[model samples]
Target: MSDTTTPEQLADDAVVVDVREQDEWDAGHAPGAIHIPLGELPARLDELPEADERDPLPIICRSGNRSGKAVAWLTQQGFDAANVEGGMKQWAFAGKPVVTDSGADPQVI
Candidate 1:
């Protein structure tokens, strides 16, 4: 099983990758998270940190399913990765910062 990290456990400098679709991302996502849909990750491997990096890549989806899969895949690829348990839904529920392209209040889509 993929390792998991809670939203509350994330550090300020952690690399957070959102694996939701473009439309979902445009709706809302964690502030400072890198937008890379799950389907695009294979081609966009360079956009992520090097496999040898000490910091783990914390990934999230609308809920946590997709990101859990991503974490499993990433770990197999030699990268330190973890799923963000509870995902964006929990982040927003925890009153964490979120942003959207529309300049409206952020909501999990």
Candidate 2:
């Protein structure tokens, strides 16, 4: 299978890393997804799930663009990673839960 994944393909509990900006993340994100802005991914590598745990860690952003870049960089570092196709927009549209830190109604920003 390709390294890009649509939100519906993932299990509800699938582990994911969201690489959007702080404000974007605060607006809405996949419930339970790890928040690691694209710029901070390098320093937060140790906080990621085990390299083999998820087989290929799923990375997301507001759109697929940033996560695609993240996947490329992570692949070069020998970390298995995949971009979430269509990103948060698709994830929310697919009926998956979006959550905010403040417990407000979630909507993709």
Give the winner by lDDT: 2
TM-score per candidate: 0.89, 0.92
Q: What is the C-alpha lDDT of each candidate?
A: 0.85, 0.87
Q: Where is model 2 more than 4 Å wrong at Cα?
A: 52-54
Query: With candidate 2 superimposed using the best TM-score fit, by how many Å does residue 102's alpha carbon deviate from the native?
Result: 0.6
Report the Cα lDDT for candidate 1: 0.85
Q: What is the C-alpha RMSD of each candidate to the true structure, in Å?
A: 1.9, 1.8
- Model 1 clash tally, residue pairs: 0
Q: lDDT per residue, candidate 1, 2-59, as tens digits? A: 6788888875445699999998998888877899999999999899855335557789
Pairing residues by index, what is the TM-score of model 1? 0.89
Go through the candidates in order and give the clash count of each: 0, 0
Cα lDDT for residue 26, model 1?
89
